[model samples]
Target: MKKEIKKIVSYSSFLALILMSVLACSSSEDSSSEEADSDDGEEAVTELHAAFAAFNSDAVTAILSDDGTEVYIETTGYPDHTSVYWETDNALYIDEPDVSKTTQDTYIGGGQGEAASFTVDATPDLTGATVATQLNTIGIAVSGASIFNDQEGAGDLDQAAGSLDWAGAHKGPGVYHYHLEPTPITSDDDSLVGILLDGVFIYGRQCNYTGGTPTDLDASGGHTSVTQYTDGVEEYHYHIINEVYAAGNYAYQPAYVLFAGPFQGY
Candidate 1:
């Protein structure tokens, strides 16, 4: 009897050990599955809402090239512009404007002024014109209908004109952002120019800048600083700095680019 009882106790102990091992393995599998599902859910959300993001990732990819350089026109006070080159590393190479040069005649007194006068005459019956035409006339009026002498026949400016449709499509009501001059995205074959919807501008993997800090100009012109982080670097958006500061000497700091997608940090 004693021998039979001992045999039975030993067998029971072995079966208990096997049961514990099975439970442990099952718990680990459940935890791992939950983690994977969480990751997948986050990716789905990013894919769904990417279009509403302030910067268009696809557009940036299309325009910026490897080892390319870009120039940003600063219209803060004196309309000073700066050029930055992206080699192996991002670097700023400032280009100062020559004040001695007079405005070119070809760009000045073109059909733009006459067109503005015609718009004013036609504004009496605004109800008759289409919304697009009325909006174009309003843009001309806000810009003072002045002919830009230095801007005539420039391919850069022409590209900006082409991008107006894209800008208008993405623009929000009361959000006023404009690029009077061409923003040259220098590529080897052909250069591209486009206006940014937000105050911020991102030039590929190399560098990014803002004309002024983010502001809500729709209601009232107020300032908000946007900080972006990407690839282990943070950058601030540049915008029209204070007019009191010298044009070329405006303050700028490195900020980050907020990228949303599968490669969030990249």
Candidate 2:
């Protein structure tokens, strides 16, 4: 069932085109875009971005909106990988003794069962000014977990680094989320991490375009170039900056901040 859904989503361009056509005939100017609530100068997409295929098929389902101007990503928010946060009875659980569990009783799926849905513009408004990311899930990782900013509570992430597992993620009172580079998904090399709330894909430290650390990144660790998924055409995307975060007694020392953003794609 999961494989079938993934196949449909990964190759639903034809279906998306039909939907777009229908929308075009009925309402031409009412597609959502960069201005979340506005439809002016909106661009309709023909399909879901190919990068979405990198997400965990078992836990995530990405679909094009009826108007074809937005992508809806729904996830179980349960990672397919082994983690200290998983309940010991669950198959993916692992004992990371070095990691400090958030609470002896707190575990993934212990609360409301970490499920979330997000709707983002198919085409990000790059021409608009940058927008800052707020607290909570800023994006979803390919591992089917939430991607958070370098923050824990109202304070900096330094205070909670010890709680993070090998994946640089931990379960707070809410969902299990990553605060630093999720090495299980991407390390020093260039790999598709996930898509951000601003509708831009974020990659690992090294870029496939240059085969090394990008030299021309904006303040948000984003640049325009050909990623492994872009075929030959250059596209705008974000990368995990190569700089080490050097925070508290983190299990992984010299960790890279996943994303600290004033989103350029919004």
Candidate 3:
């Protein structure tokens, strides 16, 4: 009986050593991976500003420059896409066939055409407050159109829903903007839509290009995850939830905020 007890104790000790060894190795690897990821994150953030240089449209003119601290942008505030806001005589104007059936938006008319300038943090960091997005032009799409908060103007989004165009945009008396996911620039479910003034990225419906909603998102449509533009580097970003996910139970998960919900920890 004693011999058997001794054997059991020896076996247990052996198992304990193996477990400790495995845990130590795992912790070491995790630390190394985190350090490597930190380096990659820095590089990714630096190159982000350069992505906007790809924007080119006759109706819209945008220029991007980085100052090692922040990104500066200058835009003519025009969109390359078809809009009723464009005067019928202008070459870019196209009376979209479905506009009448959709939003039935009319040209309200008025306001000067002025070039706009903006600056955003080159590396947006979380603070400790939820910023109010209502009635604010939070960001600009790659197409140079303003991106408004989820709310149409100030209150419940229901009242403003009808005014949205078929592709989800309409011109104010002065400016053209989008209140939901803009369609023109989105190539697929996992494409980069735009960058917010706070320096967060906006992506299409799918969290990943391969297909699948992103996991682990916070209240503000954002999460640290791998994105196509970052070349495998994970960064904090927001995704525009497709209509299907925005409804029902899925809203409880990372899919809640349609566009990164009101600048989390602003």
Clashes of 1: 15
Query: For every model shown, what is its TM-score relative to the native structure?
Result: 0.26, 0.84, 0.66
Instruction: Tell me how many clashing residue pairs each candidate has.
Output: 15, 0, 3
lDDT of 2 by residue, 53-101 (tens): 8899999999998788899998999998899899999999999988988
Comparing 1 with 2 on lDDT, the higher-scoring candidate is 2
Q: Which pairs of residues collide in model 3?
A: 220-261, 221-260, 221-261
Candidate 3 lDDT over 35-55, as tens digits, reads 987755432233544445546
Model 3 stretches astray by more than 4 angstroms: 1-50, 57-67, 97-110, 243-260
Model 1 worst lDDT window (10 residues)? 257-266
What lDDT tens digits, residue by residue, belong to model 1 across residues 1-266? Answer: 99999999989988988888888888888888888876533221111111113322322222211222221111111111122211112232232232111122211122122222121110011122222111221221111221121121233222323222111110112112222322222211111122222212222222222433333321111122333333334422222211221123111211111111111110
Which candidate, 2 or 3, has the higher lDDT? 2
Which candidate comes out best when scored by lDDT? 2
Q: List the residue pairs that clash in candidate 2.
A: none
Global CA lDDT computed for model 3: 0.61
Q: What CA RMSD would candidate 2 show? A: 16.1
